[model samples]
Target: MTDTASLGLEDRTARVIAGQRVWDELTPLLASRSCTLLAAIAYVGSHGGELIKLERGSSVIVDASVSAVRAGSTDPSVLAEWIGAGVGVYSLEGLHAKMILAESAGGSRPAFLIIGSANLSGSSAARLTESVILTDSRDCLDEARSELLAWKIRAGKPLTLEEVRALGEHYGADRSPGRKRSEQDDTHDAATPSEELPGSTPEASSASRQRPTQLLLVRLGEEFDPPSEVIYHRDRLSSELGCDDADSDSVLFVFRDQSEPEWRLPLSQGAYVIGVDASASGRVTKQTEVAPPGPVVYLYDDDDGGRYCYLHLTESSRDVTWADVTAAFESLGEKPEFDRNYFRKSAVDALLSLWPEY
Candidate 1:
């Protein structure tokens, strides 16, 4: 056993962390801007980036081998974000170790090394039985640094944006959501041969396969033109749409007018789709006061059925009407009806194309 007192650990240094205790030890180190991080882990599941807050100069190496991507063990989407943020993301075939290295920003303190079974994944952090050894001892740090350096060299060049995008496509295709009756029975007329629908573009197709966006329909008390901003009651959303605050991420909401004909998408107006957080009373509302740069979408209801849809694009986007949208869907053997609020990017793009440009 290592001497914890000498290391100022109070029974800490060279400590073994298991389960959520790993985060209890790790988050403080990451929160310090005075240190930089490098992680060599075999698998990074979807949205795994949320776990490790990587600084600009930080680095990560994962087992992004063909089999890993196909198995959904490595998520290219998170990798793509890391690359875009100028983080050095690399791939090493046959990499199975889970390790992290943290060095003082100015190289003032001895580097710390964390090694063991925990992966940089939600499952590992939240549910899996994981263990790791954390130590700032000089000898262990030196040996681990050397090992990570050797692997980094073997990793060669960091993945380029294009390479990561290609990997994302492959990953998405392999792990495509399994077809279900709920998704198909409402929108799709029938399963026709796989082919691009009329007016479909590669960009549209790619965007559609990405994370699905939810459309929240808020009914207005009176019919009128699009307002500068609209307010929504969080409690009402929970009661009507079963949309809790936690489900508000990536959600785009539109106001429905209390007019005749029941236009699900009444008009195209600018709306903010910011992240939602609960208020003091355990409810979220437009007045909750959140930051900006969140998703902004133009709201519209197809009016074909009592369904609302949201376009992923912003105000300075394309415009179309229900007629244009239905024509495109029908061309591909799909019905114009959008029974549910969750829309794939393809559906959003289709709606964006028909929505009137702001």
Candidate 2:
């Protein structure tokens, strides 16, 4: 007689795993299971394709909200495949929980349940920094199953094959060539310089030769003095700002001062500092009183005729203050007081005490 204890069923309860550990454990478990049900507030179709290919699952429920579409999280192609494969498909308006329930073949293996911050997408499962709690506890599994059932009964709307097909066609058309740019795409384009400028010749119109006449330093609500160091490059600026065009007039350029250790801006936060041309004219339309939680500084370089080295805060925090910005500059080895006299000097020594040597 085989000892069930040796099968490691008891050891599977209540553990947190992240990254590739999610894919490594989830794939084999799905393959061995007879019935798998997935409920996620968000779902991507490619992930659905992969899941259906692994095992014939009973059902999948996802949220079909405009926000998900704007974020490019849901794919209709995968949803169509789900319906074609005889898997039941459902959508709920406000579904936000992510859970998976799987029952083993013929009661031969322990049932499994997963709950976590991960979505049912390949990027979330394999690439993103995601964590989930997995367990085989009968009590937990039963409770999860019951709640999911209640949600389905009260909110789930069964998607018919025709509806899935129609949605797939709509998305396909939207993705087809010659489609109009989306508002999000346009916002991204505003920050990028993809095409040649309107009236200048290629030689004189180069982005490297354009110097912003004014630099604007702004936080949530108040504006500050521009930082002395600025570095501009299309790729770096685009990536840092989470936009496409690095040379848009409508958007502000933000970054951290180079004096601090290299840190990428967190996406969830709303705080930022903007860099504008001294020649540009605009009022501070956006407002936020809270400062970013940590120290942030700005840098700029105008030697190449391009605005570079703009720094801004990305995280949202109510505790950040002007003192934090001054302190970050002080940490770079010198604490020069800023005053009206300091602004009068244009020489390198006057602009930045810790400027990098080229």
Candidate 3:
């Protein structure tokens, strides 16, 4: 007799997945055989596609509007990769729902319906407090799939691989250098804490949540040592900054001349947007090794400019100068005595408005 295993179709239950468990459950569903995936998520980060295993019969709908791309929310290049892998990638403007349906098309496995507040990004799993209602109910899965399909149909024409790639290229070429803010605004000063900090309330509103790319402002002293390689202390990252689960696409902006009582411009002409690969609070050494190791953060540049590049600085501070760099910091309430600190997305947008030639 052929060995038999139950697909667990009779179990029609749902459970809430919060914290890191959200990704723990999702990986298996994405890798399940004969399970067709249908996702309608709003934001697709630069590495979002890489997280998916790319099922043959998968179909994904995302917000691929020009505004979303320019805002660095949806990456068209990621969608292009999915399309290249034979995944049906569709673009729906202003799509905000995050739902994934994995149903066995020609097998005995039970269907899965995942509805949650998380986006299709690594940050959602790592940084955000996301909860998904996972159910093995085939009926619920079918209904959710139908609704997603309707949205897909309403999205109009599907994007071709070339078209998506071109869009990504266009976005890269057409991105603005930076925006300017009035020097009078100092609401984002690192010295003055924002009203809605992390864990300030019993529950966090949608507005209180941190952005995908949180900015780290490093004040480089005249005598401060600059490491040839990018590194961050684990304690400084976790205990001090509460960025224990910082996204890999996070940024680091350096500034100079903090020692001066009065300075013309503070923002360094050279800034490295460090993409944190790995962060260890304590010494992490090989099991077989006896030598002590120091805390470190593995850094790399991802090549989407300073914004997404992982390890290296996409722009050299030696190349460009921002005429209003000091003004930009002042607008964000950056104090003269400020040292290395973290800035939110709103403040980052205000300070780092200019890009390549800033």
Candidate 4:
């Protein structure tokens, strides 16, 4: 019951590739009408400038805003080509009944059409629901495109929070289709609310925002699997949870070899990294009405003897509660105390807990 696809189409940027088990018949199409086809498999975005990503395999539970990667058979090259496309390239690698690709992927940025389902896990996915376009008629592809490039140029790699926001200023809202323009969301001006900004607000800034004791990261394998698998994508995801600061904001750097980013840095210095899974989730689900509700983070040990933590978070704003937090902590078998008042310090402790496994 796996699905995938490769596409070959005329130059126009209007078409749909939606179906089950579609990967087998897919193909990659290069640039056309002055556009380059682009694609990749990664959940990327910024929250107050800290780069937060639910990279692969991990399932993040959040309201659809930024994107929920589509499903299908994915080829690395095709995925890469999708990113190179002229306008906006949204690679819906997994998270729905069908895999999808849309937009010119060149000359403009594209807004995502995320969806929801009955179950977020790969195993329960087959029993999940149908495709639901979370945000159609984005009308911001043009703005997002410019901002995307500025973000790429600033980071010199994949998009980061600062870079993502840098584009926001230029590409804030709706982008007229077929006409590339700048979005004003991420832009800075004398009029922007200063209190909630990353630099001014401790709670709002990625640099100051406190997080839970642990974080989670997930990567979709060839396709979303009823059963997920572990993967080691080192080299691309910097060994040190690669991160940098731009425009005074912090974010995780991206890898050129891979179109996706390598890490999701904490919004604040106090955030921590923790790994979650079905086995672990079961314990937490028992304790609360709302689950952790997003991609699960985990501690990963590459064969090379490096240890780093991952996060399963969204690009746009995300909200959680004390009940969910308490449930996550209660699930640990004999966890240690976190160093700080917030979860930031606990995330480090959580990652250390996995030291032996690596």
Candidate 5:
């Protein structure tokens, strides 16, 4: 993201969270300089500029451009916006980078600061692309300033006082100790629509569809090695499961045959929905789940059949029950929502028809 390291400047004096993940190494470095700014985030959709506390920071710049997307090309711009939320996490542009942070400092070369290759989504990667990271630079700082300004004006995405106030309003009004974001508050409406894309209600899209069959396998990539605690806690059904971290791939993987891969389910097996829900807290929970909801699915529905549907658990760690889950499914059945329709984009019918029943 331009010069990614610039976000960590000013001893936390001024911090900006522009859709990217702020890092540790850049922490001490940016704090050293009085330069202030939040980090930038990347994904498959749009770059929404900045998301900061607005307590004591300014001079925020970001490279959230959508021009990166085009036929047969690597577009970083199209992948700059999905970092703040979890809607399209594994899509090519969505999974491009794990929150790229451009330093608050100016003049870092952006061409030298990216992290991955192959258009982010793990797919038909004819090439092995390589991206870099720039902790500090003046050139990058300039580009970021330009980028954010453009998105704010053209795309209408800007980190402003009004938006911050809105976030505060939503989070503050519910500070009633026991109050939670997920707690039923009819007065507080859920922004996500009841239903959005194809086959959204588990009724099967009226037209049989074909979707990019990308399987999230369990193998770890170059990015990270999860901590012991993190692993122990999530090991519930992750051991023998593939696609556990499919989203982890900088690039999304695709297959013509659903059964070709040893671990993935076939096209006619189960329905997949990308829904937005909140817990007791105010967080947009997006996922690709099996059985819609309400059913507490097991790790391996069929051992010999090699069929299994997984509900992606990005943040929630609590054990999910069938009753509540079914209700969720019921809720999902009510409606669907998202900037992009994953099912429609990639024909999901083939996969659903093959889902094995318990």
Candidate 6:
């Protein structure tokens, strides 16, 4: 027998399912048939364990943020089960949308789509007050599938087995009292009376070793004589360059050099811009933009050298780091020596000239 529809009593095409009823309705649907499941949840917990019971074809995509897998929120055991079941597990950075699409063979119910404020967690599905739209509309399911496929395409890379294992280890370690205390001490650098003596702490001795460094947004010039570099202090630009604030976690480095032969500049020096997130945190987070299937862009020397390629920042540009850019190029099987030299005056001019084009 078909399950009794619970919430969203008002809408004809969609129903609002709330609280524990959300799981009540979902669990039966998942178990009744062999289906394909696609989920994008911002946060997950042991309650997500329900997914493990799904048939072999099911897939799940989760946000890779640390907070998503925080000790109390996500159950590592559940994740491990999903991985061991040969389920397709992926991580999409900056993913906050919570959705589930289930497609089944010919039956009374062939497709189902759930989208709502609740994440895949016990509190979210059963305890906390939450709302989700339950729909069987073909249009809604089709659109969701298309959007999800697009997100998967832009993810560039999936969370590997090693990454998942590391999450489990970290979750386990963070729960230990000793590990928590060590972490607290490392961040605070202060000791209690019962702890180490006043002047004997390791942090006290290492205070002199901290070095001052600044984040810079650089632009390489047309001549490529001096690689462009911007230097600033405390997230503020000290230079006369009229470029926007460089304090953001990610900064764009525009390369406007004359195109060179693929052989001369194995990395293919051309007019393209790349963004680097200098902030130490969230370096692996992918951008929302639909990035091209391959590297950011490829450059080939135009015979005249006058043909310039201008890159305007788009919603789809990936949030990467200097390290990521270097690594991506390296993966191309070409090791091009990157110019690390910082030139102040030339860097300013290059930005100024390119600012108008952007």
The lDDT leader among the candidates is 1
TM-score of each: 0.46, 0.46, 0.46, 0.23, 0.26, 0.46
Q: Best-fitting candidate, measured by TM-score?
A: 3
**Candidate 2's residue-wise lDDT over 1-358, tens digit each?**
1212323345455666676546666555566543455454345534545643423466767754332332334566666666677666677643557787775544455567878766656555555567778777889889988877776775546677777655553342212134343322211111112222212344322222222111124323223454344324434444433435444322234432222221312211111223212212333222212232211122232454332333322332123334443444455555433211121223213223221210
Which pairs in model 1 have colliding backbones?
Answer: 208-346, 265-300, 265-301, 319-354, 319-355, 319-356, 320-354, 320-355, 320-356
Q: Clash number for every model?
A: 9, 27, 18, 83, 81, 2
Q: Residue 188 in candidate 1 has what lDDT?
A: 14
- How many backbone clashes can be found in candidate 2? 27
Residues 204-253 of candidate 1: C-alpha lDDT, one tens digit per residue: 23332233233322222233244333333323322232224365332334
* Residue 326, model 2: Cα distance from true site in angstroms: 50
TM-score (C-alpha) between model 4 and the true structure: 0.23
- Where does candidate 5 have its weakest 10-residue lDDT segment? 185-194
The segments of candidate 2 whose C-alpha lies over 4 angstroms from its true place after superposition are 1-9, 51-57, 170-358
- lDDT tens digits, residue span 155-196, model 3: 777789877876774342212234221110111111112232
What count of clashes does model 5 give? 81
Off by over 4 Å in 6: 1-11, 70-72, 172-358
- Candidate 5's displacement at residue 247, Å, is 28
Better of 2 and 4 by lDDT: 2
lDDT of each: 0.51, 0.43, 0.48, 0.27, 0.28, 0.44
RMSD of each: 19.7, 17.4, 19.0, 20.3, 18.3, 16.1
Model 5 misplaced stretches (Cα beyond 4 Å): 1-25, 32-38, 41-155, 169-291, 294-358
Ranking 1 against 3 by TM-score, winner: 3
Assess candidate 1 and give its lDDT: 0.51
